[model samples]
Target: MAREYLNVRVDADLKKQLQKLAKRENRTLSNLVETVLGNYAKRKSS
Candidate 1:
């Protein structure tokens, strides 16, 4: 699949929290965000 770039600004604390979760899950921050957003989209579509 073709991927596009997205730029978003987030709070510092939130960024830190995401980073921690990403590290724990052995995923890059971008991958973690993509997976999370994908799941959210699936839920909303249902």
Candidate 2:
């Protein structure tokens, strides 16, 4: 499947923390971000 890309700026410390969290979960950083944003969107829209 094809996928689109998104680019955003975040604080350096936050970026490092996200990377660590993703590693601990054994998921790619991109996948982690997608899951997080997807959940947030679903909660807000309902």
Q: Report the number of the highest-lDDT candidate.
A: 1
> What ranges in model 1 sit over 4 Å off?
none
Candidate 2 residue-wise lDDT, 1-46, digit = tens = 7899999999999999999999999999999999999999999999
Cα lDDT for residue 45, candidate 1: 100
Worst 10 residues of 1 by lDDT: 3-12
Clashing pairs in 1: none
TM for every model, in the order presented, reads 0.97, 0.93
TM-score of 1: 0.97
> How displaced is residue 25 in candidate 1, in Å?
0.5
For each candidate, how many residue pairs have backbone atoms clashing (under 3 Å)?
0, 0
Best by TM-score: 1
lDDT digits (tens) for residues 6-25 of candidate 1: 99999999999999999999
lDDT of 2: 0.98
